[model samples]
Target: MTKDHYWPKALSKFWMDNEGKVCRLSSEGDLVRGAPAKFGVVGNHHYIDLEGPWSHSIESSFQAADDRISFVVDALNSLEAKPSNEEMAYMKRFKAGSFDSKSKNDFAESIASLIVRSPGFRHKLTLEQKAFRNEFLPDLPFRDSNDLKVLELRNIQIKYPEMIASLRASGKIIVMFSDSREFIFGEGFLQDIDGPNPLLPCKCFVPLTPGMAIAFVRPSGPYFSMPEVVTIQLTPNEVNLCNEITQIYSRRYIYFRSEQPVISKEFTDNVYYFLDYSKHPWMDGLLAAAVNFEDN
Candidate 1:
């Protein structure tokens, strides 16, 4: 089979190898081998692996995934995928069967780094609350991945319904994809709600906000980051009590989206992809807060 016939046919999947290193193996899409895409949507052109020294620059991975990175990120920016004309348009561009690999690869660094939710954000000048304020805002004008400004916040919110409701009732959620579990949405705010109750087992009232990096997505295709949460600050001992007591972290790889074509980081954040939100069971309110940002 030729490249055109096979790439659209296979679906890509990611998993961890025994060495604890992240490995991505495809179920199909090898041009030499004729295998069809098992999933409904056409293949993401799924190439781009971010690991090792190159994790800082996924140039090789983009070369490998055929640059599905640029396609998806581009499609996401101007067009909203709907079942009607919009969705069809997205697929047309996605499966256009030809790509300017050279140009796209030149722009690969935009989505090169995955924002992380590591312990560093809390104490360091990087990823700190003040850092977030200095760098990001409710509304960011368009900018390409090359000039992309992004921030990643970890352990953002809880999955429970009551918690989500409490967050929504508050306006202008203040989490900022930063360290505090503060939600300042429409009318009410989670920062005022008090973070997760340390007294309860398995209940993260103030769950650590997922590490989310909010960046500028240039029309030329540098993608931005997304996240949602209202964390309850806990002391190290309290954190240990919660860890010894309940499962708070969202299962990795099982519940997050990636830059694809490139593995950007080691862990997952708490936000849902905008492309996934409409159909996602309980994420409408959260999506609104994140997308509704405007320069004040």
Candidate 2:
């Protein structure tokens, strides 16, 4: 069986430290550093059928999309707060032209790949499939296929192509940078802004590097007329919020480029407490109150 990387190495490589390895903080707060290849990998993660010959079609698509986006990300990595006129012009051109049609499709495919290629997503797929099978096909002969078969149903390239297409068709891509604060990435951090609905997120955020991140905002209501690609520097509080979101939504490990931990132990404790609190019905009222308090 082939080893597949759920997190594309190209993207993960951006988080490398001075020693050329990424720092990973586990949910339990154990910190470790390793090469990009050491994490986000699973054997036959894209494998669809045991009886069928192995194919690289899906992996190839991921590679193609990653290769294209790597250029954009690389440019973002080298970007400065006060860009030269040429650089600014290039960014403007990219906003006006590159983020349309085929390029936009590539961007969407890349984001969708990150979401659906994770172990968390696979597990979700497994549970949903198991539920459906139990409810409607309990007696079917193939209903008891191994977990591998069930999990592979999350191959986004095949099963959820429309998600990529949907991303391409709508939403503005915002590229945010921070000179004062660093950003952290989580294993399953492509989170829905409104809630847990992944298929149609009102907004979503992904931190590409310690200095940069991206968000896809559905263009409607208050967010109408948003540009196709927006590049802006984030406030320190906004940067913290991005890291907090990654921590809350992460399945297990959070990755960063920092040598020392960027997030505090107290913050982690609060995040765990919030996670527990979120399970109760009254958490909504609590959250509303917190938001109202913040507004005041």
Candidate 2 local lDDT, 1-296, one digit each (tens): 77788778888887788889988777767888889768777786676664556533356656776776676576545544432132233233223212446666667767777877766556555666678867997785353465436345634545457556656654566666777778887655543433222344354567777888876655233322334555556666657766766666565677777734456453465332224422323223222222122101
Cα RMSDs of all predictions?
Answer: 23.0, 8.1
The number of clashing residue pairs in each candidate reads 48, 0
lDDT at residue 262 of model 2 (Cα atoms): 52
Candidate 2 similarity to native, TM-score: 0.70
Question: What is residue 69's positional error in candidate 2, in angstroms?
Answer: 2.6
Q: Which ten residues in a row have the lowest lDDT in candidate 1?
A: 183-192
Off by over 4 Å in 2: 52-57, 75-102, 138-151, 192-201, 219-226, 259-296
Per-model TM values vs. the true structure: 0.18, 0.70
The lDDT of each candidate is: 0.22, 0.59
- Return the lDDT, model 1, position 145: 25
